[model samples]
Target: MASDLLIAQPDEGPVLDLAGDLSLVLPSDFPRIVKPFAIEAHSRMLWSELKQPLTPWLLMLGFEDVDPKPPWLLPGLRDLQALLWLAEQLDHKINSSGDGVVTVVLPPATQALAMLQLARQGPELLDSLWDPLLTWWTETRRKLSHFDRMLRLQLPAADALRPPEVWRRRLQTLSTCLNNPAHSELVLALIGDAARWPVLRRRCALMPLNSLPLSRIVLQGQGWTMIPLSDSGLPILITARDGLDQRDAIRQWWGSASTPPPSVHWGRGDQQGRLTLTCRVFAPGVEKADLRITCRDQKLEISALEQRLHIPLPEECHGFTPLSARVKGVCIEIEFR
Candidate 1:
């Protein structure tokens, strides 16, 4: 028997009247016994009662239908149109004050699913949803003004937010679906500017070693000084200027000095736009003294050269070592041991 359902006012109590035959059945039996009638009834009831003041009663009824249903059992074409109309109306009210918090009146599960479906349709709807939230956050919810905070609150499911990072591995992915240059530019504009993005700024601040301009150097000998050819390939070059008394000592050291310097080697590694320079020094009967060196953007300065000569060495090794190095705005002492 068909039941005549009396839906009361939302803020009011239970139904005031019932006028048709009643057939109470388990919710599981709703799909079989009702055929398409249940779906039609659900949609019609929602639309007809939505504008009415039946709040608590309608809300309870809507919450009862939350279950896995066959796709064909989903509300028909006309019902979807009605659903969209309701959504658009609710969205308008939420966004009216330019605040992001839209007062969505739907069963909780239904509300989440609707938002997810809207997000999947296009970035436009996503933007519409987000823009209002952003405005609200900026004007009222100041504590949740940041993107990270907003995302955390809105996207509760961890699995849904994993696409951006996972797809960013490829340039095409970033350009096509994740962060297109145009979209990135818009996001940057919204967040103030590129300067406001600390992460992007940090990446920009790194000046490639190869891009640094070259500077002059003076290499001194016994009675004359000569400026040798600057090697752009090697990041570090040590030049020594000896006093008259130390000239002979310097000569002996130069006699044994390898043309390319046994201490120096060069190659490339994982990072792009940079080269690696490796240095090693080993001698017999040395006192294991520490090496002191300083580097500027375009030049290297060796101090306490006498100490570097006294440092002992291991039998064999392969790696890069930095002798007190300084880039334009950075300093790093690197030793891969």
Candidate 2:
């Protein structure tokens, strides 16, 4: 059978030899048909391997070998152009939808520019011009609309807002559109500003809230008492007292403990009906962390480093404390404490 006789020689670049076919012809004729078939099969395999999203540039480079006069070259070029066009469309859609617009638009624009450069060097050059131009026009319109919105919104801007660098080469289009230097600079400035605004806004938003001086304080709920500790005169000290939920109290007191403490031995106290809590204000980041606690009928304040905190239980009290505390973005712990 032909299948049994066909042998592929790897070292010879995929040569397939057929012995059974064309017995009437000389042995040299065997190579004529088999070698071409092997080369075609190899080329098809290579093309299949090249058809990956990450390898478009490599595939484009391989297209350098494609004959400009070949019937297949035009269709293949059209397909590649279609892929690039689709990518451009998807990129615009993503940019319009608040996706990473800068990342989406800039790299593809650069790649299109490079492809255009390569195409200009080749025989069928004009065919290369249409795809990049379409992409550029579509992207530029979207960018301009975005910049207009940013200017209206008083948003910060970046550098890409002007007519694309590629526009200069299209003098006919530029002349028809009346491209003046003043107009060009203004558009460019707006595009640049718009591109940079989001990053700047994000940085500003992530900053810590402004610190404020402590003023007058008051107890907001019943069954809760606020006590003022000895103020160091520089920092403030305050405490609150309420009926204790043991789990909540421990959670509030030791929420920062990465591991369980050896034991939390508490001293017995008289139910003077008042649970006295002590909170000593430490310097921000140095002292015990702040805790904000709210019960059904009371609120309490406790510190992070304090070993013992007094929580008063009132007769007929029906409430539990919910504690929450945040240290900027570094840590936010909410349990009982």
Candidate 3:
């Protein structure tokens, strides 16, 4: 049996968010992992690159003991690399499309930059209001293509005495008016800039709409929506609108797991031999991962499919090595000499 935990960066778009997840194993049968065991667990990651602290434990566990005969180098279950490669190829296709044209989707960061430009150009909006204004824009705008179109709407200087919330709501209203310029009466009521409203409406209407529906990006008041496309410019539906897509995405991100050297220990109860691997996720929401185990002793081999392997030892299964457990891309191998 395995227990899992998730920790992750916030999902808001900055684009530079760290993308990879590292799983930390904290195997325990008790209510919580003991401290020394936990510390040793974190030190297992190659990213940690810490070996001095693990040397003593390595000596004690003797997990590295293996036959001196030429060690067999087998193919790895490298799903993590495949997923990352898929993501990179997708990004390249996105960036290379339309002859390196810029997207119309005004990310929150880009909106802030636009506001700063407006400040320099003598717009009444203050410097401090950029974040709040962009947040309001992001939350209220539902359409994907028309998403960044709201940024073109000019904001009037807000009263310094009023609360920040007032400014956000006011900006939302102004954005609504800008997005619906055909309703002149509504625009007049929401946006006080009578002189600028007509000009904004004309400019927004003239701006070219070149992005195809297949390639267009949108934020649906939650997060950026990803609609993958085929080469023929048709949207390739990967999954339904149900939350399964989210759950699977979380699983892939968190599934590549690593573990410290495992060793034998006393059983919890008489004859109740069990192995519990506690996997902690760097990003939250993933509760499950597939595990495949392969154990071999020179031509006498046994393989446990991801679902078939479990902790409580099955009777007739004497220990065998080298043993390997794979979680997505992570392949933890323990071979005895």
Whole-model lDDT values for every prediction: 0.28, 0.28, 0.26
State the lDDT of candidate 3 residue by residue for 1-337, as single tens digits: 0112121212222121112211223233323212221212322332133243334334444644422221224432122222222223334434456232111111133232333233222213323534576555445444432533555532222232232343334333333333332311100001113234333222211111100011111111122144321121211222223333243443443333222111111122222354432221111111123223344332222122211211333333445332333222111222221
**How do the residues 1-337 of candidate 1 rate in per-residue lDDT, one tens digit apiece?**
0110111101111111111112342234332212122444454544453433333333434653333233344444433433344333433443454432221122222232343234234334334544665565345435534754756433222222222221122223222321222221110001112233333222121111111111211122222232122222212122233322343433343233222222222223434554444333211111123235544433333333132222222223233344333221122223322
Question: Candidate 2's error at 166, in angstroms?
Answer: 24
Native-referenced Cα lDDT, model 3: 0.26
Which parts of model 2 are misplaced by more than 4 Å? Answer: 1-26, 29-34, 37-40, 54-337
lDDT of 2: 0.28
Candidate 2 lDDT over residue span 71-136, tens digit each: 244444532332233233333443456422111111222233333233223322433554565566
Q: By summed lDDT, which 10 consecutive residues of candidate 3 come out lowest?
A: 183-192
Per-candidate TM-scores read 0.16, 0.14, 0.13
**For model 2, where is the 10-residue window of minimal lDDT?**
183-192
Tell me the RMSD of model 3 versus the true structure.
32.1
How good is model 3 by TM-score? 0.13
**Candidate achieving higher lDDT, 1 or 3:** 1
lDDT score, residue 21, model 1? Answer: 19
Q: In model 3, what lDDT does residue 135 have?
A: 57
For TM-score, the strongest prediction is: 1
Flag the better candidate by TM-score, 2 or 3.
Answer: 2
